[model samples]
Target: MKNDSTPITKSRGPAEHEVRAQIVAAATEHFSHFGYEKTTVSDLARVIGYSKAYIYKFFESKQSIGEMICGNCLREIEAEVSAAIGQSDQPPEQLRRMFKACTEASLRLFFRDRKLYEIAASAATERWQTVIVYEANIQRLLREVLQAGRLSGDFERKTPLDETTMAIYLVMRPYLNPLLLQYSFDYTEDAPVQLSNLVLRSLSP
Candidate 1:
């Protein structure tokens, strides 16, 4: 336990940085096994061999730690989506691949660890910064694909880019949002392809 007299520095040393990393690692493992909502900073302190006050030095609250973990899971999904769409395929094919990849990546998270899924659910429900950034990135990726399609003269130029991107993102929202996704799981396999095809047709020149 850090004494009240201990002077907290404005900057973190390498040792302090390592301590932060350890706290995050321990929290992630604990949350994965026991779920995020059920765990408290006190619980983390007990498990991490640190005082609650000490953990507070690294993270102000449990949700702050949950945000980091949830952010990671969402970013991993985006990374997978980026990789899947990295091919030189036509814009139509690329878009289809994006949808499929997103569904796969999100499903991977749900099936990998339900406790982690619980974190995602809470994040999505509460509209955390991670969810905001993740959704924006998805829109940005959609905009890029739409731009490519239009440039190739394969998609209609009548619809504005912003409109098209938002429309497409809204269509894909259920697959992207963990909270909404749980209710729509049944459509995961066929929805991506069929929905992508439908979107492609709508965007056709």
Candidate 2:
């Protein structure tokens, strides 16, 4: 007599992408609330209903998660900058809108949660690759605007394209840097207009 037993298959959990998203989301919350340095893989795993090893399966390390969060932040800013740039045909106006969009986005994120801002700052300093890409993206946007301005005779080409791009980025540092904005005594209602006007004048033909 032959007795046969039914075969059992191991159950599959969430998809890899799903698990990664969940991990990133949970990590974002903890990092935003507790901070990057204080939050750990165990904390993320506990909140995510998984083991620390499971969390590691998705991210290589805590710094990787921080890089993901910072990358997401930069992606959002790029989207906003693209939208603002697309909405205007005039170079000066486009430049103004781009600057406003980027600064406002940064300020909104920084003001909404100081901890998140700190996390991003930390990631920017610790994750050199991410910072390099982020800076390159910003430079590309500035270069596009400056090129448009030069083509339209709105801005005089006083310096090389590369130099002008860096100069614009540096000039806008006060508005773009969250840490600097936090220390500004006059970052009130009139700050945007004042900064925009100053930048426009500097770029004027």
Q: What TM-score would each prediction reach against the true structure?
A: 0.90, 0.85
Candidate whose TM-score is highest: 1
- What range of 10 consecutive residues in model 1 has the weakest lDDT sum? 1-10
Among residues 3 or more apart in sequence or in different chains, the pairs in candidate 2 whose N, CA or C atoms overlap within 3 Å are none
- Which pairs of residues collide in candidate 1? none
The CA lDDT of each predicted structure is: 0.81, 0.72
Off by over 4 Å in 2: 1-15
Total clashing pairs for each candidate: 0, 0
Per-residue lDDT over 41-110 for candidate 2, one digit per residue giving the tens place of the 0 to 100 score: 8888888889988777667778777777777776676777778888988889988887778778777765
For candidate 2, the C-alpha RMSD (Å) to the true structure equals 11.8
The segments of candidate 1 whose C-alpha lies over 4 angstroms from its true place after superposition are 1-15
Error of 1 at 179 (Å): 0.8
